[model samples]
Target: MNSEARNQHVGKVTHHELKQTLGTWQLWGIAVGLVISGEYFGWSYGWASAGTLGFVITAVFIAAMYTTFIFSFTELTTSIPHAGGPFAYARHAFGPTGGYLAGAATLVEFVFAPPAIALAIGAYLHVQFPGLEPKHAAMGAYLVFMALNIVGVQIAAAFELCVTLLAIFELLVFMGVVSPGFQWTNFTKGGWSGADTFSMGSFHGMFAAIPFAIWFFLAIEGVAMAAEEAKNPKRSIPIAYVTGILTLVVLAIGVMVFAGAAGDWTKLSNINDPLPQAMKFIVGEHSGWMHMLVWLGLFGLVASFHGIILGYSRQIFALARAGFLPEWLAKVHPRFKTPHRAILAGGVVGIAAIYSDELIQFGGQTLTANIVTMSVFGAIVMYIISMLALFKLRRSDPNMERPFRAPLFPFFPAFALVAAVICLATMAYFNFLVAIVFAIFLALGYVYFLLTRHQRETAPTDALLEE
Candidate 1:
């Protein structure tokens, strides 16, 4: 094969054969794995138990925003199917400056999200074992999944497929067990809170809970970054996209509505990991099934971490190829055909995050949750940029062919942008310091960009540039 043709291939996927590699089921697995991993299960239950209606309202709002955002991206990806994701799309629409910011923000999102998932997995494992230190457990989880990703795409895909199937079964079973315990009164009585006398305070508190609810929907778009790796990306992508989203929508609504009816809000509210809480309530004791469900939930989190790393590394590779990062990050291993440097970089970031949390624990603040919360703030910023990119691209490239044009054109983008702004507004209101710290990181990225510009323009950046 010529260099150009070879460059377009992934594993056995030749330029012409890329479309044949993915059947509908495999693509659906990828998308569902990306969006509705193990973590989604517990969190959905927890948020539902907190303020079921309030949380559900926020969930729907975020889903609408993300649907708009993903549809816009689908249009962009179909026209210019690059692995860098929003950064590549932004670069095409708004040039290098916009691309650089989007890439930098995404790097923060990708780097922090994996560790956060690891930390969650570690916490759940600690709950199960009570012997493991959080950092050590997190490291083990990170190492295991990082190895899976670095081995090659097929291994990663297989792991994701297994985890996705297991997670779905786990959710269905939890729903079935908990169905008998749901309480109708839980959904009706003072369903709203933090407001007195039916005042605006109640309205504000309802909106304030957007982040906790929105977290469930945020993983959906992650599938887009895997476009280049998928066989038949153009067709497989939309199929997975629609199906994965519909699945989550149904699951979220069903879990929230039924769980709200089945269990008391206060019963599930105090728990961070709600799936186990629901199982414990439903089972009434620690049975083998309960243990199995808990472990499966933890597995789901690990699988999610795996999916995030796989997709994010591709973003790193694509950005590296486009000159936004060091070219080594773009290198695909000769045998593995994977971005080894990017994977290592992702590993380093995850370790740094865990280490910093350990230091805070040593300081007696136990600030790991706070640190992860900052990452949520950073993710919100990325969401804002993505929404803005949609609007900007619509005006800049109206003529570009889009296999899936975002419904209602500019209006959808505008609505999503508004919702993103609302989420940011709430983030600032509730956690202004976290928002400030997150912004400082963005500023740091900008400084890094300035310092590296000269090198990116002149340096060859990789010794193994050819392969």
Candidate 2:
């Protein structure tokens, strides 16, 4: 047997085998990038589009929901210490088909976000060299990161650690310079007049913001993919999930409120790049430091791409082993033990998406919107099925071993399921047409699953059953 297969338990994984592979510090680096996704999504939502107070409120709600969901997933991960993170968990709980769908949805999350990140990277590179070509920059960013991932997990983890640390430091530096200028008066003064009818002060205004808030808080599970590589995952996974979300929430609220209060909200509407604009306006001409902050923050785009590639390569590897994707995509490099083929395949898709976006006219109603909304659709669907798996496994496989058990059993599982359903309802309300598009993707995945089943390989035991 291979070393990995031998290291795993005879019948089930035990706590003893859960030793660290890369290093605790490197693992921590990956978690930091995962947690800071809140900041990335915050920029995408744009303070100008959502207003300051409203954005802070959304951040708070998302943090709480995210914390709860990840904590529950940690329980699932520890219970079944397998290579496939969510895909394995789903199979253990539900069945083969559910596992297939969960894996497919997550693959979409990892595969599709590359273009957006690449485009953002291009935008930053454009700033330093105004005449630089965007497509070439985007393609280069994608290719370099793909090559980095192909090298090995340890190398990718180190790169992620460095960029994540720089990104955090830059954010802190910019916040420090602009923090003193915060004026509480800006929040209430000249708020919501004429064409913009949303009021920050009214209860009705807060209620209307939930849909936007849901969009802002998506993608917290981006960290769950690290389960296999983590040391003492049972303990570490829960802590990282909670800690990461809390850190982002506090920082996001602080930056949004302080920046808004320090300057004028109307000024936000006029700025194309909100972070640098807010920093410059608050810090005045002393704002040369803000330019440095922009470059560092831009490095975050690179860091995020690295984390996503590492995370998704594992997902692709897991699905391939389970007979969903082609066998070739499942191959691990002999020296690196990383999914080299999957990484290259993912790079191709990411590069293509980047080119496609550049060639097409992207607006509010376009593939960008479709891809982003579909990620939410994937998350919600994955959440519901996984939750059900939690409850079902507890009953059907009561004798199965579990290292970490979710608190309150059926209740927490039920809570996660209901909360996800509510978020889906919110998505439907805000954009039914977008909901329809997401539904189409899920249907297509299911159809693909149906066509591939007849040709799938069977374990020796399954063949015995047929005989």
Per TM-score, the best of the predicted structures is: 1
Question: Residue 269 of model 1: what lDDT?
Answer: 57
Candidate 1: pairs in clash: 18-232, 19-232, 181-262, 182-261, 182-262, 183-261, 183-262
Off by over 4 Å in 1: 1-24, 37-50, 194-198, 358-368, 458-467
Per-residue lDDT of 1-467 in model 1, one digit per residue for the tens? 45554444332222111122345576677777765653354344334333555566667887788777666656766666667777776666676678787777777767777777777777877887899987799999878877878787777787788888888888888788877777777554556552112444455656756666665765566676777677676677777777777787777777666655665555665456666666676676678877777777865676577888887787787677656777567777776777777888888878788878444343222355455556566566667777777777677767766677777778877787788788888878766666666788778877877777764544332221221
Worst 10 residues of 1 by lDDT: 11-20
Q: State every prediction's TM-score relative to the real structure.
A: 0.87, 0.84
Error of 2 at 179 (Å): 1.2
Off by over 4 Å in 2: 1-20, 35-37, 40-50, 190-218, 269-272, 358-367, 408-413, 459-467
Please give the lDDT score at residue 396 for candidate 1.
72
- Among the numbered candidates, top lDDT falls to 1
lDDT of each: 0.67, 0.64
